[model samples]
Target: MTKRRGERPPVPEALPVPVVDAHTHLDACGAQTPEQVREILDRANAAGVDRVITVADDLASARWAAQAATWDERVFAAVALHPTRTSTFTDADRAELTALAARPRVVAIGETGLDYYWDYSPPAAQHDAFRWHIELSKLSGKTLMIHDRDAHDDVLKVLDEEGAPSTVVFHCFSGDLDFARACVERGFVLSFAGAVTFRNAGALREAAAWVPADHLLVETDAPFLTPHPFRGRPNEPYCANYTLRDIATLRDVDVADLASTVTRNAERVFNLGDVVQSQ
Candidate 1:
């Protein structure tokens, strides 16, 4: 049957081992209330995606993401103003973001970096915001989650100039193999999203195949980038399971082994040990 446009994909079969959706936007996925959040997570858990890191793109979402994290033991948060939205970033915004970063369940500072694809925010503003986020990550001792879109060189340049955080993760990594090698060489973690499963993402697949287990992670980036066979559909955290299966096939590794490795990587990067234990 031809699925209608914007239809949500059916929950996939459970994975041999559970994995985490290293990045997603629960708010954008229509999970605002505690009941809504649990309903979404329950679907994901059934498909073997046991935990998730819900990322924010602005102050409002950042606040929601942090609050949502506290609501569910299986959910964590990354707070930041997205690069494209940085044009209007203010001191008041910084103060609030700093406070949000300190929240116990806010495990990362990010979804911040360059995004040349959209002109919503000027480059200068984006650069300044990205640098500030880098500092915030260091100060808070949390992983830095980057959203690099069509400005890879500048993203790395800015990080280099400001000394990257001890733990760096490129969310929804869209780079080719060469760029992947550059990030890996710098010890930055590369997180593949649903886009990696796209048929034309050959270079991305190559990079996915080459990344070492410890440096690799997977995400759904839900409410967007639905994986193949269901591309263009509405996506939620549960879809990370499908992306994980594709990556496992791409790497020619056992699905269970890959799940375990990425789950461990997610736990280490996001400091999710206690969260997982409580779950």
Candidate 2:
């Protein structure tokens, strides 16, 4: 039989608590316009998601994401050029990003870092651009949302050498347990996405078990990595449900308690007080 909201199935554990999706891309996903974004946010809000950090990978989308945040109190913006989009990083792009970061709705400087998976941009160019973004985050004093894929060593090196802002989040963390431990050692927050719910994510689950409650976070990375039982379908902000459930399971904590902890963690790391209050 299907269990109720607060009811736990026969597992001897508490029911999973609902939670806020710490990171997402509601504006870019299926929602191509302001109206669509509004609808998506409405649905997410109804699902018990307290907030979403809508990120943008390019100048146009970044602008759109930032504007969406202005219209919806639950949405916050993180502006940056994804590593794959490094070719589009021009002086004009930098100028636009600088202006966007100055806005109150823009809470972080990223979705930026290395992605050696596709080699979309030359390694040298990506490195240079990553450094530029680091400088931008430092200058703005905003949290940094990093995307390190198949380039953890280089990403960590740059972060260490250049010195990331005090608040740095490793979004959609897919690294091994060792990497997770290393990140925790450096006081970095690891934001897990839907991938954590996949049956094959044993390593991720192990890492999650070790993550400090205060440093752990959850995200949908929506429009991608839809959690299992919903995989292969278009992802949305509301899909954060599965991710939060899985995280609570891994951490061996009640979902409600975990949700409350993560909410505080996201707020502290992303400076969400003013943004959340304004919403």
Worst 10 residues of 1 by lDDT: 270-279
TM of each candidate vs. truth? 0.97, 0.91
Q: Kindly list the per-residue Cα lDDT of model 2 for residues 1-279, writing each as its tens digit.
A: 122422211211222444567788876576777678778776776666757899988888899888988877777899999999996578998999999998888999889999999967888888888999999998998888999999999999998899877889999998888999889889999999988888888998788888889988889897788777666666777777667877777778787898888888988888888765655
**Which ranges in model 2 have alpha carbons more than 4 Å from their true place?**
1-18, 276-279
lDDT of 1 at 205: 89
Clashing pairs in 1: none
Q: Itemize residue pairs with steric clashes in candidate 2.
A: 17-255, 17-256
Worst-scoring 10-residue span by lDDT in model 2 = 5-14
In terms of TM-score, how similar is model 2 to the real structure? Answer: 0.91
Report residue 44 deviation for candidate 2 (angstroms).
1.2
Q: What is the lDDT of every predicted structure here?
A: 0.93, 0.82
